[model samples]
Target: MLQLQVPCSWYFWALAFGFNLAMHNLKNILISVVIVSNLGKIIRTCTCLYKQDSTEHHDHIE
Candidate 1:
């Protein structure tokens, strides 16, 4: 009969690889979310300014 044992070092390497992958993915997600949120804010601000400018123009004509 032959018995085989798994090495502990293999588990250590696997843990390190998983940790690195998770950190990299998290960083990418955070960056994309921040960019999207900022873009939305910019668009909203522009629209508000345009609306105000248009209202002022209409009042001047009246």
Candidate 2:
């Protein structure tokens, strides 16, 4: 009975540790994903604005 108890407690502790690690990693992944998406949106908007500005300038020169 004592031997069985030791392994059972070890397993429980291992499971808890793994769960905590998974949650931490999940949070980091979500944060990175949000940052990347926002960056992509900003870049796309900037490119569109630059294109419009250049085209307008070209028309004015002509």
TM-scores for candidates 1 onward, in order:
0.57, 0.60
Model 2 Cα lDDT, one tens digit per residue, 1-62: 99999999999999999998878799888999999999999999999999999999999999
Backbone clashes under 3 angstroms, per model: 0, 0
RMSD (Å) of each candidate, 1 decimal: 6.6, 6.0
Best by lDDT: 2
* Candidate 2 TM-score, true structure as reference: 0.60
Candidate 2 clashes: the total is: 0
Q: Candidate 1 at residue 8, lDDT?
A: 61
Q: lDDT tens string, model 1, 14-50?
A: 8898898879799888999999999999999999999
